[model samples]
Target: MYYDGIGTEANEKKGFELMLKVAKSSSLGAIHLKHHAQFNIGRAYFEGYGVEQNNKEAERWWIQAADDGSPNASVLAQTMLGMLYSRPDFLNLKQAFFWHSEACGNGSLESQGILGVMYLQGDGIKQSEASAYECLKEAADRGNVYAQGRLVQLFYNKKLFTKASDLARRVVAYTDVEELARDTGCLAAYITKGIAYACFYLSRCLALGNGLRMDKEEAEKYFKRACELDPVVSHDFHLDVAYGIL
Candidate 1:
């Protein structure tokens, strides 16, 4: 409908009118059509494409689209809803948990990983190690880099070294830590708690060859990476002895 406008002159109003007509249709078997139309309508409002810019209106449409269960729109809505609830300013823990769970169940890898963290730390939901492990494992298995990193930390905390080492190797293959005070996904829970829980126990295994083959050079690499990610992990021999404290 806007094709003519694009070739001649910009006509956002005309585009918006056409989009509204399609979005208002009550026809069946038009799930994708409705979903996309609604999404575009929301975008139009948000971006002032053909209407007055209004975030509240945009969010309302997005929420409706998400609840409509259009696959793509649902995912987008899930993400938007999760982000809205997760914001420190909004801080609706119950709603955040609900939407994140919905998104996770719908295969949003980021939601799965974040939901796992919430479960592990009891931030928004009741802490349940079993649930945490299941969500984190699912996300990690899907090759989400951040999820893989967090899974390594979780398994390491549980003394599941084989699992930890396996995941750590996968993460190291893709990234390295340049800062300790950020969300690289691996140390987020540990950092936020300010307790220095030693997120890189598997790194020591690589360095000391305890259950894994000893490779001092590689150990040193992981040591530096760990320390940069969290200063608490300066390969503190004392923490190793005080393991149960964290």
Candidate 2:
């Protein structure tokens, strides 16, 4: 409780001691403890936090934790391994896809989002816009900001303006840009969707000469904001179309 802050202030020392205690008594707890400890140890090694920085050691511990069925740890390990394999000297696209697929199958939103991008871009897998859309939509629905931005792009490509606008509204309502900036985290998928939707709305407003004056600048700003958040191919493509560049 103290370790997790359930009922008391968080204490890493106490948490470590309690983990050790649990490991001594139950095999399940032991496995979890080992997995968590190795994950933290890997991070420590990777970041040089109270330990000498060592990518190899970090990989080793991450792999051990992954082998122990720690889903998140496995995802991180697989991503790192994939990155290593993707180097010019290695150039193993197949292996990269394999690890990424494994992590995606295990429900890692980051992996899914990356996989979606890869599919969309035909990076390693065959280019399949439909597949990318499906993957991104699933991840976005799960609250991945990156995925949400991609989803907005997908909607724009399909000319589904109403749906896109709805998605954008949801993002604007649910996301906090300041908080995301502080952590350098992606905005919630909905937020990206909302920006795209807002851009589309602005464009429509300009075309119809609604209450707002016909302002290309305002429309462009919204579009730029959407691009800044996600920058998916479809969003860029649509921007070109809207500006007569397509």
Residue pairs clashing, model 2: 145-188, 145-189, 148-189, 168-193, 168-194, 171-190, 171-191
lDDT per model vs. reference: 0.65, 0.61
Whole-model lDDT, candidate 2?
Answer: 0.61
Backbone collision count in every prediction? 2, 7
Compared with the true structure, what per-residue lDDT tens digits does model 2 show for residues 100-127?
6877777666667767777887877899
Candidate 1 regions off by >4 Å? 1-31, 37-58, 68-73, 175-220, 223-246
Q: 1-246, model 1: which lDDT tens digit per residue?
A: 472375667678887887777778876756557766676677788677779988777778777767744346656566556656777766887788887778777767667877887898897788999998888788767644556666776876787777677667656654324343233333343332222223355556675464568787776666566666556444463376469443
How good is model 1 by TM-score?
0.60
